[model samples]
Target: MSTDTQHGESSLLIQLQHGLKREQFERALHDIRAGWNRRELWMTLGLHDVRQRYRRSKLGPFWITLSMAIMVLALGLLYGQIFGQDLHDYLPFLAAGFVIWGLIASLVNDGCQSFILAEGMIRQLNAPLSIYAYRGLWSILIAFAHNIWVFLGVALWFGVDLNWNLLWVPVALLVLLLNGLWMALFLGLVSARFRDVPLIVGSVVQVLFFITPVIWKPEMLPGRALWLDLNPFYHLVEIMRAPLLGQAPALANWLPVIAITVVGWAVALFFYSAYRWRVAYWV
Candidate 1:
């Protein structure tokens, strides 16, 4: 608290700022690497978030599975009748797509709050900012872990083929998680600076749910509309859903997802490198 000590601290802070300016990208990479090294901390925090959200509820996290099962059953039955599709086929497809969609939707929606929700920690802790991104992604993955059971049950009931193609599921999930990380970094940074971003993101996600092939098959569209080809969510979901349903996702599906993942990371890393230092103040 002495004047000399205060002056020295201020000088060090200024020097740190100048260093960050000159090595912004390196600093961003360092943050990510450091965050990974502290996975135990974020993983514990993420698991704590899941448990805390369901505290005192008898069903606890199983509620995720139950709710997803109910939605899939209701939609599968109604849509099967309406579209004249076989219940056997439609239900499994719906279950798989809905489960994958749940992961993607939660990642994007929760990514918006990745930094904002950690405002106190961000301000007080001298930890890597990327930890918040990892924490948010881990929490959503926990939810997805629960939700996947719904699809497994439906697949069992429908006798959906489980073949070698199913191995692709882990790869698809890895790709999705990579996409989720960038989304958390990018969206979290932007959302920290703009309070309205979460609301806008939520609205957009809801709209995308309908437009994406969650409730309907792509072939349901006559000639497979051009827009379906362009819908990134369609490809994202297909990459996961196809494997769960015992089909290897076509190159068509993998191509768009790969392209999106690359472009998204580039954009995310650029903004994250430039503005990561400002997040503590913004949040």
Candidate 2:
């Protein structure tokens, strides 16, 4: 072919690539909207997952509450003595932070399997892939509901003050859930293609729990520390934990949480739009 003919073909290919990308982006948005519109379906599936996990058990889902309560009590006693902190203050803080961390961690860990574990459904069903993400998030939220009571009990035991700021807990949870949605979709997509991603994520989350001030306090740091500010998990926990402890989250915390949410969704949607259709095949 002549130089001009080859150049024209290249230009045509570029145009087609852009058009394909635009089409994929539109379908991605539709999948997200359609999945949300079918909330009732995912919600039921999520609830069934929770029940199925505890079927034939005496305590059912309340086992989550019992297990969390035991963990909070054990950690509170051990760490309170180790850190020389008063139980009254420390337990409530630990409980609030730990429960919030549970939700965040579970959202991430289970989010990896959001598509992988739904392999059968992905292959056999024609539902939007986002529904699997939603189902995983809802299951995590159900567990969070069970675990929140542990924090409430700790608050009551410690005589933690309740104030108008407590109202922010719901708003904080709503924001966290928004973040979780993207996390599930993004991580689920990646994990579907790379089986090892979930293992890596699980290990990372375990390490983060130790360093993110769940069983400890940020104030324990002797001086102004940069790592605490840089730790997104710290900000995430603080956003919810502060409200539960009857305080407004610092502007510092809100800024990072909001920034992460916006950036996370943008990245998640870009990849999800580009590769969502491949999830079925990847799984």
Candidate 3:
């Protein structure tokens, strides 16, 4: 094309880039609403992500199950012996704790990359940022499903009681997913702008893995149980793990988790509203 023609085209593109748009809240709302309306898109993308990751592997996603099974058995036996707890009790507890921890940790770690990983698509398409967040959470949930088989097998082998309280499993999962949404939005936004945020998030999650009750029982904390009570992950894990182990989680567990979910969403919503417009540039 001629120089003038190319210059005019570039000017038009710049105008479109800076064109009139909705206010921040409306834009954020539209991003979410439009994303929800296109659930199939993100769900397919998410599942495809899982499938693609394991595409050439002989065991595919079953590798997740196998690795988790090995980790649970190894850790359960070692920790049970060290803590002098009954194998029957500790194995099932470890199984439940590992499964829940995997879900929480994966969501937080991967959620940080939701937008940055989708940079190409975000730049090329006029889609909602929430779509990328959904894809991240859905992909993690798919992997969680794969890892959960180890827990089910452990429960069955140990003959853990299948009480009606197990219904809380899905409830707890729903709460986790809700929390995942806001976390994905908030973390994804921050990580897109600050490349260091993902590194920081991964490091924090790694530290939390040891501190959280994944391999160790909270009873080890003794009179310091109040510290565990303050940990949101402890409650999240207990709500799911207690039910799976045929026990009811204390009311304190449910209350703090619910409170965190509420407050987290509010903060995420405000931050998202303020920063959603800048994501494209940041990414």
Q: Pick the TM-score winner.
A: 2
Taken over the whole model, the C-alpha lDDT of each candidate is: 0.91, 0.91, 0.88
Candidate 2 C-alpha lDDT tens digits along 240-280: 88888888779999999999999999999988877787788
The C-alpha TM-scores of every prediction are 0.92, 0.93, 0.90
Lowest-scoring 10 consecutive residues by lDDT in candidate 2?
Answer: 11-20
RMSD of each: 5.2, 5.1, 5.7
Q: Model 1, range 1-283, lDDT digits (tens) per residue?
A: 6355556647535644554564898999999999999999999999999999899999998998899999999989999999999988999999998999999999899999999999999999999999999999998999999999999998999899989999999999999999999999999988997899999999999999999998889888889799988999999999999989999779999999999999999999988887888888788
Q: Which of 1 and 3 is ahead in lDDT?
A: 1
Model 2 bad stretches (over 4 Å): 1-20
Pairs of colliding residues, candidate 2 = none
The positional error of residue 41 in candidate 1, measured at the CA in angstroms, is: 0.5
What does candidate 2 score in Cα RMSD to the true structure?
A: 5.1
Lowest summed lDDT window (length 10), candidate 1: 11-20
